[model samples]
Target: MSNDHRRLGRELDLFDSDPLVGAGLPLWLPGGAAARHEVESYLYELERRAGYQHVYSPALGKRRMYEMSGHWHNFADDMFPPMRIGDDELVLRPSMCPHHALIFKARGRSYRDLPLRIAELGQMYRAERSGVLGGLSRVRSIALNDAHIFCPEDQASAEVAGVLRLMREAHEALGMGEVSYQLSLRGPGGKYGGDDASWVRSEELLRGALSKAKISYADARGEAAFYGPKIDVLVADPAGRSWAMSTIQIDYHQPERFNLEFAGADGRRHRPVMVHRSLAGSMERLFGHLIEVHAGAFPVWYSPVQLAVLPVGADQDDAASSFAADALAAGLRAESVHDGSIGARIRDAAGRKIPYIGMIGSREAPDGLVALRLRDGRQLDPMPQAEAIALIASIAAARSQELLP
Candidate 1:
C-alpha cells in the first residue's frame, strides 16, 4: 500500500538495482523498458511536429568540449572523471548542450535558420555520491529529453514561450501531478557564467515570455544554471514534496563561448542565442515521480500492460490468442495469461494494475467476443473482440485518464 515509487517499482517489477552493476545505475526491466519506449516515441513525435530536428550524438565528448561549454569548469565535481585514452581525455557528457552546440556549428546558417531546433534523447552520466543515490530519482546513468534552439536575439522570447507551451502539453499527457513553474534566478556567490547585464536581460526575457503566455510562476533565487537563468517545471509527488522535472533556460554565454553565429538579413555575422530546454527531464527520474504519483497504475496511454487476456480454460485459448494478436497489431501493450485458473488469473491481472481484462469464455469465444473486467472492479457485458480492442486502443491513443469509456 506504499506510495513510494521505489517500493512500487519493485512490486510491479518495473526496474531494479544490482550491487554488481554498482549503485546509482538501475536496470530497466522489460515492463519498464516497454513503457519508456512508448513515452520516448511520444516525445519524438511531439518534438517533430514542433519543428525539432532530432540528432544522434556520441555518449562521450572530449574534455575540452565540456570546458568550452563551461560544464567542466562549473559542474566538474558532479561529473564523472574523464577517461584517458591515448592523447585525448574523453568524458561522458554531463549535459547535451555541448554536443548540440557542435551540431549547430556543423553548417553555415542564415537568418532563415534562426530558430534551428535540435533535439536528442541522449545519455549522460553524473558522479553522484553513493549516499545521495537511490532508485531512479538520483542516478549515475541518465537519459535526458534534451533540446537546444539557436535563434535570433529578437526571437528568444517567442522561443521561450513556445517551450513553455510544449512543456505544458507534455506534462498533461504524462499525467504529471500538480506542476508549478518557477523563475529560477542567478543568485549571489554562485559560479554563474556571463555578465550581470546578461543575467538581467535573460531574466527580463523569461519574464516577458511568461507574461505573454499568461502563466504565473514564483521567483526563486540562486537556482539558475551556471550559464543562465531558467524557467523550471516542478511536479509535486503524492507525499507533497516538490521535485524539478523539466527546465527551459536562455543562454547567451554558450554562443559567445562556442563562437556560434549566423548570417543576418543584412549579410552580417551575428551571434545566435541559445535556448536550452527539456520538456521532460531525465526519463529515470520522471518515471520515479510517475510511479509514485500513479502508484504503479500509469495512464492507459503509457501503461506497461494495458490489457490482460484470460481465456476460460483450454476451450477459449484460440479465441484469446486471436484477440491478443489483434491487440498487438494495433500497437497495444497486451498479454495473455493462462497458467492458472480463471479466478487466479483475473486476480493476478488486477494485482499488476492492468487497466482492462478481456475474459474469453465458451459462450463468448464462438461469437469472437470478450467480457471486460476493469481494474476498478467494473464488468462490461460481452462485446465484439474488435470493438473492445478498438475502445481500449482509442483510450490509450487519446491518453485518457479514465480506465473505462
Candidate 2:
C-alpha cells in the first residue's frame, strides 16, 4: 500500500507547503490550481442547475453572530481567536451557516420563499491542530461547497430529499460510485440546542427521507451536531479508508435562536426549518481524497494537463506549438515540450500521468498526423488532430479515465 501522502501534490507538481505561511495552509502550484478550478466549476454548474442562488459572504464576522448561532458555546475550540477591532471582536468564520442565516434575516421572508436554497463556494478558516495537518486534508483555510435551504416545517422532508439527489448526481458525475452514507445522531448528555421532542421529530424526518430514497446508510448515535442530526456521505479511498465528503443536516433550533420567522398561509408567524448541506464538504479535503483515491492519476476532466505534445527536436517546435494551440482552442488542456528526444518527452508526460501524449516528428508532420500515447500504455497510429481533440473532449466531458481508441 502507498503511504497516503506520497502519491500526489509534489509528484504531479500540484502544491507544496510553505513554512513562512505557516502549516495547515497550502500554496497551490499551477497544476494544483488548475485541478481546483475544475472541481469548483463542476460544483458551480451542478448547484446552478439545481436552482440554488449563489452568494458570497465575508470570511470573517462579528463575534455576536457565532454566539447567537450557539457555535461560540460548542465549537469555540475549533475557531481561531477573535481579533480586536475596537470594542468588537471579529472572528474568522469557521462555517458559513450563521452568515447565511443573517442573509435570510436581512430580507423579510414569507411562505412564498419557503424553499429558498442559497449556496456559496465559501472559503472558511478553522484552527486545526498542527499535527493533523497534511497536504490539503486538514488545512486551516479551505473552500466549502456549502448550501442552505430554508423551508417550512412541512417541507423539510422534500428539501432533504432534494439535497440528497443533488449529492448523488454530483458523486456520479465525478466518478465516485462507492460512497456510503452515515446518519449521525446526538448522544445522551450531548449539549444540543433543541428540546427532546424537536430533536426526535427532526431525526425522524431525516430518517424517513433517507429511507424513501433507498440509500444505504449507517447510524452513528453520538456523532451529531449540537443543533441537529446529519447525514454524512463518506467516500472510500483506493486503500479502503473512508473520508467524509458530503453532509446533509437538519436544523430546527437555529431559526428559533436567531428569531427567524416566516408568515404562513394562515397569517401566523412560524419558524422555518433549515437544512445545511455540502456536496463537497470542503475543497481541501476533497482534493486530498482525490489525490489518494486516484493515486495521482487524475481522470481526464480533472487532470491538470490532459495532454502534452512532445516534438522530437527544435526543428519540430513549430508543429508542436501549432498542435498545442489547436488543442487549447478546442477546450482540451495541452502543452508543448520541444527540448527533448521523443523517448524522454514521452517519459516526462508519463511521469506526470498526463491522460494523453502526442508525438509530432518529421514523418507525421507532413501528413498532418500525430502519434498518440495514452496513459494505459496503448499507442494509436498517426491520427488527424480534429479526431484526437474530439476524442479527448468526449472523455473529459464524461469524466472517463480510460483511453480513447
Candidate 3:
C-alpha cells in the first residue's frame, strides 16, 4: 500500500488495533474520538429535528430475541457465539432493530402514535474473518446511527419518504451532496424470509416512495436484506470511489413474528409497518471513507485543529498565544507552536492540512496585526487579529475544505 493510504489513520491519529485485544477491534485515539463526536452530534441534531425519539439498549440480549427476529437462521454465521447465563443463552447484538422492536412492544402502542420514529446511536458487534478487518472500514465492533419508524401500512410510503429526506439532508451536511440512491430488491432466494406478496408490496412501496420524492435511483436485485427490501444511499468520494453509507429497509415479517400490534382507528389490532433507516450505516465504515475522501484533510468544521498559530521566534510567543486565544474564543479550533522555526512550523501545519496559519512577529505584533498563511502557502496581507479570527470562524462554519486567503 502507498504511504498516503496506509498512514491515514496513523497520521490523523484516528485508531489502531493490537494483537493483545484480538482482531477487528480498534482503540480510538483522541483525534478519532473528536471526529466521532462531531459526526454523532450532527446526526443527533438532525434526527431530533425530524422528531425521532432517541433510545438506548444493551449490547447483549437473549438468544431467543435473535431467533424471534429470524436473524439466528439467516445471520447467525456473522454473530458471536452464545453465552451460557445459567439456563438462558445470550449473544451480543448484531443489529439494533430487534431491540427497538422490543421497546415498541413494551409500551403497546396505538394508532395515535403512528409514524413513531425512534433513533439510537447503537453500538453493535459481529464476528468477521480476520482478512476482512481493516482500519475503520470493516470492524467487529461498530456504532450505527440506527432508527426505526412504525407507521401504519397505508402510511408506509410517506414515512419512507421522510427518511429519504433525512438521508439527503445528512449527506449534504457532510459535504456529500452528490450522493446517489440504490433500490436493492430481493431475488429468488432460499435464505430470505417472507413470501412473494410480502416482497412485492415492500418493493412497490420503496419504489413509490423514491418516485414521489422525485429522486433518481438505480435498482439492484438480490441485494436486499433477508427479511426486507431496502434503499441504500451511495456517496462518491473525492477519488470517485463510491461507498454505501446509509439504508432504509421495509420489514413486513418481523412485526408479525414478534406479535407486535397497534390499535387502529377502527379499534382493531393491526400490524404496524416497520422501516429501518440508518443515515450513517456504520460509524466504522463512514470513518474509513472519510479518511480516504478527504485524504486525511478534514474540513474545518470536522478538523480537530482548524487553525494553527506559529510564532516567528520565542520572542513572539505571547503574541501567538493571544492570537490562538482569539481564534478559540470565536469558536475556531486553534493551536500554537513556538518551538519550531517559521519554515518548520509552516510545513507542519501544511502536512496536517490546518486551514489557517497566523505568524506573529515584532513588526506584526506591535501593530496588533498577524501575517496569515493559508494551507497552500499563499500569503495574505497582514490583517488585524479580529478580522483573522472572523475569517477563520466563517470558513469553519461554512465547512470550507480550502483555507481562506
Candidate 4:
C-alpha cells in the first residue's frame, strides 16, 4: 500500500485527523479546504448542467426515519450508536437516501415531475473499524457526492444513461483511466426486500441502460444491496490499483417501502422508481486517491497554491508581495514568502508540490519581471509580469493538466 499519502498530506498541509477530535474525523486545513472547495464547485456546476437540483438535509436524523427506509435494520452495525432525544433515537446518517426519499414524499407529485433529480454533497458518518482507519480514504465522517433520481419505471433507464454520461465526463476530466463496470445483482434464493417481479424488472432496467450506454460489464451475483441491483464503477490508480469510486443503483424497494406516490397519466397514484448515484463516491476517499494518483503534484487549477513567489533579497520583498497580489487578482492562488533564502523558499514550495514558482530579485525587480520556474525543473528567464500571469491564468482556465507552452 502507498503510505506516501500521509507524508504528502502533512507536507502539503492538506488535512489532519486528531485523536482529540476523534479518530477517522479529518480536519481540513486551509490548503485542503481550498482544494475541496474547487472540487465541490466543479461538481455543483456539472450536476446542475445535467439537470440535478441541489438539496440539503440534517446530518443526524431520528432512527425511526431510517427504520422506515430499512437502513436501520439492514445496516445497523455500520451506524453509530443512537442517542436518545425527546422520545426518539437519533443517529448520524450513514447515507443520504432516506432523507432524500422523505423530501420526495413531502409533497404530492405528478407524472410531469417523474424524473426529479435531487443532489447533495451530504455529510455522512459510518462506524468504520478502528484498525482500518487510514487517513481520509477510510473515515467515519464523509461528504458523499450523492444524488437520487425519482422517475417512472419507463424513464428510469434513460435517467441512468444520463448519469453514465456524467460519470464518463467527470472521470475523463479528472484524468482517471479506463473504468470497469460491475453489475451487482441479487443471488438466487436470497432474501430481498422487494417482490421477485420488481427485482427482476429493476435488474433488467439497469442491464438495459448499461447496454444502451455501450458500457461492458461483469455480473456479480450476490453483490447487490438488499433493496436493489447496482452498477459499480471501478477505476485504477497510477499504480494499477483499482478502487470502486462511483456507483449507480436502481431501487424499486425504497419508494414502495416509504409509500412514495406520484400521479400517473390516468390520474392514479403510482410508485416512482429511485435511481441512486454517487459519481465521485465519498469526497474524502476521492481526494485521498487523487492525492496519491497525482503523487502530490495536483493540476494547476486544483492545486491549493497555484503559484509561489520568492524574493531573492530583502530589496525585492515588497516587489514580491506586489507580484503575488497581481497574480491573485488574475484569479491565481499566489503567495509570497520572504522569510527564508530564495533556495530555501523554492525548496519548501517544491516540497509542497506547488505548480509554479516565481523568483523576484534585484535583477528581475528592476525590469518588473520574475524568474519563473516550473515544477518539472524547466525555467523561463525573466518573463514580463503580465505574460507570466496570463500564461498561468489561461492554463488554469483550461483546467489543463499540462503547463502552457
Candidate 5:
C-alpha cells in the first residue's frame, strides 16, 4: 500500500502538480524530462526497426472529424469541449485512430501495401473530473505511444498477435515486473458505438489473436473502448497492484464510419480493418507505474543521469570533467559533480539513483584511470578512463537491465 507514485514522484522531482494549472495536469521537471526523452527515443527506434512508418498529426482536429469517427456520439463525456474558430469548431483529439484513418484514405492503396503501420508518440486530452484525478496515473493530458495497423480483414489476427508480442517485449525491457493480458469486451448498458454483430466480430478477432499467441487472459466486461473490443495488458508492479499499461484494439466500426478503402488484388476497392494499439499505454501512466515499482532508480539506459563523474576533491576536478566529456562524447548521459566534498557528492549522486559514478581520485587522476561505483553499492576495480567510459556507455547503449554488463 505504501508504493504510491505521488510519494516518490515528488521525492525524486520527477513531476509536480499545481493548483493554478488545474488538477490532473502535472509538469515534468528537468530530471523527469531527461528520463522521458530516453524512453521515447527508445520506443521510436524500436518502432522503426519493426517497419513502422512514423507520422505526426495535429493535437486538434476539426469537430466534424470526431462526429464522423463516432467519438462525438459515444465518448463525448470523456472529451473536452470543442473550441470555436472562424465559422468552425476544433476539438482536442481524444484518440489518434480517427486521424490515422484519414491518413489511410488520403491516398489510394494497393494490396502490395497490405499492412500500413503508422505510429505516433502523440498527445490526447481528457476531460477528467477533479475528484478522480491524481498524480500522473490519472491525468487530463496523456502522451500516448500509439499506432494503427491498417490491413485486410483476413490478416487482422496475425497483426494483433504481432502487436501482443511487441507489447510484451516492451514491458519486459521497461522493467515492468509481471505482465498479464485481459480481453476487454462490451457489456450491457454502455454507450458503445458498434452494433452487436460488429462487436462480436471484433471480439472474435481479438480472441483468435490471443489463441494464436498462446496467451491466457481474463475477461473484463465494460472495459472495451467505445469504438471496439480490445486486449488490455496489465502490469503487476512491485507493490502487488495491477494496472493496465498497454492495449490492442480491433476496430471494424471506425472503418465503416470513415468509409476507408484500398485497392485490392482483383482491382476492387475493399475496406481495411484498423488495429489500434499502444505498446506501453501513455507516458504518464507508464512513468507513474515505473516510479512506484523502480522506486526512483530506473534501468541504466533510461536513468535520468546515467553517469555522474565524481572528483575526489578540487584537485581532481579537471580529471573528472575530462572523463565526463569522454562519456558524453560516447552518447552517454554524463555530468561532472564538483559542488561538495568527494564523499558527500558520491552520496548525493547515489541517492539520486545515478546508475554509474565514475570516481577520479588522486591515484586514478594521476594514472588517467577511474573507479566505477554502481548504484547498488558495487565498486569495480580501478581501470583506464576510456575503459570505464566504454563500460558505462555499453550498458546504456544496450539498454541492459543490469547496471554492469
Candidate 6:
C-alpha cells in the first residue's frame, strides 16, 4: 500500500487541524507553510513570466452576483448560505471566475486589451458534508491557483492552448509524470446555462486547442460545468490512483450574463470569451497529493529544512551554530542541534528526511571544517565549511534532487 498523507503529515509536522477550528479546515505549521510558500512562489513566478497580471479579489461577494452568474441556481447546494447584513446578502464565494468576470465588466476594453489574463491565489469556500471531512484533500476553505482570460472569440483557442502548455510544464517541473486530459462537455437538456450555439463554439474551440497541441484527451460527456465545457488534468499517485489536478474551463454564459464587452476592429461592442484555468486545482489538495507522492522526501528546493547541523559535543556548538547561521543567511533552510548525542541528533534529522547533515566535532571545529552526511548514508570527512555550504546552496538554487559531492 502507498503511504497515506495524513500519517506522513503528522510525522513530518507539516500541518494539522483541531476540532475547534471546524472540520475540513487545516492550519499549516511553520515547516509546512514554508514548503507551501515555495510551491506558491514557483507558480507565481511562472505565471508572471507568462504575462499574467496577479490581482486580489475579495473572498466575499454579493449574492446578486452569483444569481446573475447562475451559480445560485446551479451550485447552491454546495455553497454556504448567504449572510444577510444591512440589507445585503453576502456570500463566501464558492468560485472566483464570477468575480473575475465582474472585474472585466468594471472597465471598458478595446481590441488591444482582448486577451487580458487576470490571475490570483484566490480564497474560496464550500459547504462540505461533515461525514466526508478528513485532511487537506477535502477542505472547505481552499486557496486556488485561479486565473481567468478574457479574450476575443478568435483568440479563445490560443488562450486555452496557452493554459494547457502551462499545466504541462508545471507538472513536468514538479515531476508529476504522465498526466491525462479529459475534455468535459455538456449533455442534454436545460441543465446547461448557455445556448446550444454558444456551448458548441466553446466546446469546439477547446477541442481544436487540444488537437493543435497534439494532446490525446478523452471526451467526458455531461461532466462540464453548467456554464461551459472544460479540460481536466488528472495525475496518478504512486499507488496508481488518479486525482484531478488542474482544469481549463471556457465560460460563455457568465460573460454574456455579466454584459462583458470589448470594442472590436469593426467598432462595435462584442462579448469577450472567458477562459478559467487553475494550474494547481487547490493548494491544500495539491500539497496533500505531494506529501503522498513524494512520501515526505521533498526535493531540496521544496524541503522545509534542507540541512541539519549536528555537533558532536557542546564544545563544538559554536561552530555548528555559525555554520547553520551562515547557511540560513545564504538563503538555505538550515538548523543546528546540540541538545542530544550526535547519533541521536543525526537520527532525528534522518528521520525527518533532511537532504543533508553537517557534523562538527573537536577536531574539525578548530579548523572551521565539518564532516558532511548525505541522506542516503554517505559521508565526507572534514570538508571546509564554506565548500559544503556553497555546494548545498548551489544544488538547492538549481532545484535539483541530486545529492551534493
RMSD of each: 1.1, 1.6, 2.3, 1.9, 1.4, 1.7
Please write out the lDDT profile of model 5 over residues 1-405, one tens digit for every residue: 466778778877888988899899899998899999999998898889888999999999998999999999998899999999998999999999899999888998988998999999999999999888878888999999999999999999889888888887888788877778899988888888867888888999999889888999999998999889999988765557677889999898899999988899999999999999999899999999988778889998888888999898899989999988988888888999899777898888987888888888889999999999989999999999888878877887777889876
lDDT of 6 by residue, 1-405 (tens): 346888888889999889899889899998899998988999999899998999999999999999999999999988999999999999999999888988888888999987899999989999999987668778899999999999988899888889988887777666555779999888765477988899889889989999999999999888899999999888776657667789998888998898999999999989888999999889888888888777888888889998999989888888899999999998889999888777888889998989899999889998999898988899887789999989888887776757763
Candidate 5 residue spans exceeding 4 A from truth: 237-241
Candidate 2: list runs displaced more than 4 Å: 1-3, 237-241
Better of 4 and 5 by TM-score: 5
- After superposition of all CA atoms, the RMSD between model 3 and the true structure is 2.3
lDDT of candidate 2 over 241-321, digit per residue (tens): 677889989998889889998888899998999999999788878887777767788889989999899887777789889
Q: Would you give me the overall lDDT of model 3?
A: 0.84
Candidate 1 on 43-104: residue-level lDDT in tens? 99999999999999999999999999899999999998999999999999888999899899
Candidate 3: lDDT of 164?
Answer: 85
- The candidate that wins on lDDT is 1
Model 5 clash pairs are none
How much does candidate 6 score in TM-score? 0.96
Q: Cα deviation of 379 in candidate 5 (Å)?
A: 1.0
For each candidate, what TM-score against the reference? 0.98, 0.96, 0.93, 0.95, 0.97, 0.96
lDDT of candidate 4 at residue 368, scale 0 to 100: 94
Please, what are the lDDT tens digits per residue for candidate 3 over residues 1-405?
332333788876777788998788888888778777888988998899999999999999999999999999999999999999999999999999999999999997899998899999989999999897767767899899999998898999988988888887777666654678899987765489877898899999999999999989999888899899999988764446666789999999899889899998899999998999998788788877777767777777777777889889888899899889888888777889987678987888888777678888888988889988876668999999998888877876665656762
In terms of lDDT, which candidate is stronger, 3 or 5? Answer: 5
Model 1 misplaced regions, further than 4 Å: none
Residue pairs in candidate 4 whose N, alpha carbon or C atoms collide under 3 angstroms:
none
Candidate 2 vs candidate 5, TM-score winner: 5
What is the number of backbone collisions in each predicted candidate, taken in the order shown?
A: 0, 0, 0, 0, 0, 0
Q: lDDT tens digits, residues 118-225, model 4?
A: 999989999999998877778899999999999998899899899999998887666555679999888887556878898899889988999998889999998888
